[model samples]
Target chain A: MTRVASMALATAGALLLQGCAGWQSALDPKGPAASELAWLIWFFTGLSALVWVLVMIALVVPLMMRSRAQAEPLAIDAGADGRKLRVVMTAVGLTALILVGLTLLSFFANRTLAAIGSDASLTIRVTGHQWWWEVRYEDATPSRILTTANEIHIPAGEPVRLLLTSTDVIHSFWIPSLSGKLDLIPGHMNVLDLKADKPGVYRGQCAEFCGAQHANMGTFIIAEPRAKFDAWWNDQLQPAAAPTADEAKAGEELFLKRPCVMCHRIGGTPAGGTVAPDLTHLASRQTLAAGTLTMSRGNLAAWIADPQGIKPGSHMPVVELSGDELNAVVAYLEGLK
Target chain B: MRAAVAMLLFPILVLAACQREERDTRPQSALGSGEQPTPVTTLEPGGQRASASDNKAASFEANAFHMSEGKRLFGWFNCSGCHANGGGGMGPALMDEKWIYGSSMESIHATIRDGRPNGMPRFGDKIPDDQIWELAAFVRSLGGNAPSSAAPQRNDDMMVHPSENRLPDAATLGKSP
Candidate 1:
């Protein structure tokens, strides 16, 4: 019986642990803040569970010993009652001490997390749209300030500050693997500081629902070595690559004539529209439509041809493009990287 | 999907954009100049419309509700991001009467449609005509109620004073004209 119960408990524990797996799980943290947070969560869970088990035992012990303990206490000896009260007082004192300790632990953990980003070298401003993120890297020179969408690149081991605000409604920016969520409210800028201990790709999402495509509004944080980060930033500052292939050139012309350029901007080109995401480096992003689909030629074609089919209530207009136009546009965008 | 973004902006834009020639013949006055505008219709460059050319600037530009909607659209389109609530940052300030283009209601709409040579993105295609007019009405209202950006002791971001500076025009500033 003991063996079966232990096996069952082990199986249950394993099943519970599965919830904290995968790319989006907070418990599987990759950054300093997130790792500390995960540790704090585990510490509290263990401590609370231990206390609960003890309380349950205290409740069960009286029932199990009722025949002997209760009957013998019927005589009601004054000295024995004093001893029982002393025991209860000691238990209460222990519980109070434990509670105080846990509180201090949380306080210190927060301090540790806060101290990680004081010397951050990079500053990125993330503005929340209804269903996308407009990311701009701040720079002293006006020409050097690079603007992109959906993807953020930070140097590993160096702190980065993200200034968050909303253009429409309230939204929360959260990267479960890096840090806790911070709200992006209208007319107010909130700052969140983060540092990745190593190079990796971390997925982020909008924790607060802004509108219809709330679930699809996602962003990626790519942490790389300092050298690679600098390279990427320099590359992004360049305009969209010129369409070299014949098919891509035709697609570019069609984009100019069609409604595509009206809402999307391709740097160094005549297509300068601001209401939608800047597609200057569209193909370089990991996902399209704010993580609605993986970045690929097929998905780009599908998104342009019929956006409503992929994400209901999305703001992307369904452009009327023939098969050849679709292929050419896809060819153009795919070569943008 | 286009309608979702343009729902609040349908009728107002066409009132201003479609009628081009009639506006040229009308008397030029500053926005809210209290001079009554001549009633007219318009001819569009493309298939868009000359049908609703019979509306007046007084109706579309002076409506209180449309101005309010335009104020909301200013932030919606991230105009604040570059223009910094119209005092000017990346783009020139709209809070002042100082417009490189004409500051009339129609001229402002034209600028929005055919973006300037600098960084102003063309919003004509994505935004419906009504919303554009609403935005124009709001932008035009800025300096009308606010102090100038050139004021010695100015608090100009909110546009709460009268007569900000408009940049010098070669024709009007004792130049070639």
Candidate 2:
């Protein structure tokens, strides 16, 4: 009985701990934008709670008043009626005053949000797809702009402009630790500005119900120091790494020869398909299939073997392969960093 | 009066929600189970595709209305974003006389369905084959072969608008409520 009780307790603890998974915790602000939003939320919540308490006290006061005070209304005294009228007017005035204060507070908070956007050094155009983020880092020279998917890397402590748009149904881009939610409307653009206070990996999700695979559409923001960020940028600009091993070379060849080449691209190789994420620096990313699995040879092989089983309704197809071929492909992908 | 107007609008709002996802923009008579070329057709063209194919593909005649539908789909699918209404940007220029891949109906269909290397995204998964056929038809017309009546209408939807295609600023934005 003790053993069973301990097992149950362990399970309960694990479940409780799971709630604190900070994939996108609004309370844990990592940026100026999120911090301001957090302040606004707390202020509004506290004020609303105070108002509720006052209302409850008012509701209880009439009941709590002496029996003779209540009977004054039945006796029809003019002074008593005036006093009651004054109390009702005071309540109305308080309600109006609270509302006006909140409205001004919201207006100022909006201005604060807008102010952060004015001085963004870097601009990233994020196009929302059915179930993925197509992120592009812009440069003054069109050719120098870098395009990648799912993962976003930025220099910590610097404001960045995100021009959000969608090609299909509506999707919301939200990085809770970094900024608030912004809708990506088809044929329209909305700009969101954000910055990170410290270097860290912050995860995000599609806040809007886009389609069948909306729940699986995940992205991450990797904020790093300036020099490190520059190195990452330079590395991304270069072509895919050449395979060193014979097995990896064989896998690369197999990838190009099969239907994989029909929908995915690996830079410096003949296999260029833009319909899916670019695999030029696939190994550098932390997760596969937009955070479906951790980046590993085993996970890569599993994804290649049966993507449908892992992320049902995902665009990635089950590329059936012999075990050796699968191993080779995984090696090729793993070597891409 | 407001209540009466709202009552009148309720049914229309419900009906708007009930609108079919599939296209019925074509005429009622045209909505038939006519032989549509297999959505992934590599078969030689019969229709505007062949008329524009020169001698490269099998010929089939098409109507102006059908070609216009194909043109509408081109913009709808964001073909303009890359191809820029067939003048091309990231993808090759469809308006050019020189064809890297063959200028035949079967070849074009194959290219659309089974994407070519070097950034030609496979639309096979996202787009229906029938839509691909229409796109192929519209694209083939870009080489100055489409009948004027069958030509695509210029819509003010491009981000960088041409002088003629530009909308008034008020229209581009929504009118004031």
Which candidate has the highest lDDT of all? 1
For model 2, the local distance difference test gives 0.77
In model 2, the runs with Cα more than 4 Å from the true position are: A1-23, A69-75, B1-177
Where model 1 places Cα greater than 4 Å from the true spot, the runs are: A68-77, B1-177
lDDT of 1 by residue, B1-177 (tens): 888669656667666588732211121223332222221224446654522221335555656655665676677678888888777898888867867766777667766766777798877655545556667777887767312331122233444644436545555776654
Lowest summed lDDT across 10 adjacent residues in model 1 chain A is found at: A65-74
- Where does candidate 2 chain A have its weakest 10-residue lDDT segment? A312-321
Docking class of 1: incorrect
TM-score of each: 0.67, 0.66
Top TM-score prediction, candidate number: 1
lDDT of 1 by residue, A1-337 (tens): 9999999999998998887786888999888899889999999999899989999998999888846446664586899789999999999999899989999999998898888879887899999987899999999889989999999999998999999998778999999999999999998999899998889989999999887789999999999999999999999999999999999999998888776775789998998877689999998888999988999888898888777678765656566577998999899989889
* lDDT tens digits by residue: candidate 2, A98-163: 899989988988898899969899999999876788889999987678888899999999999999
How well is each residue in B40-157 modelled by candidate 2, as lDDT tens digits?
3335556433322322122211344445556766665567788887878987889855677666555566577667778777766445444455566667777756666766655545
First chain of candidate 1, TM-score:
0.92
User: What local lDDT does model 1 show for residue A60?
Assistant: 95
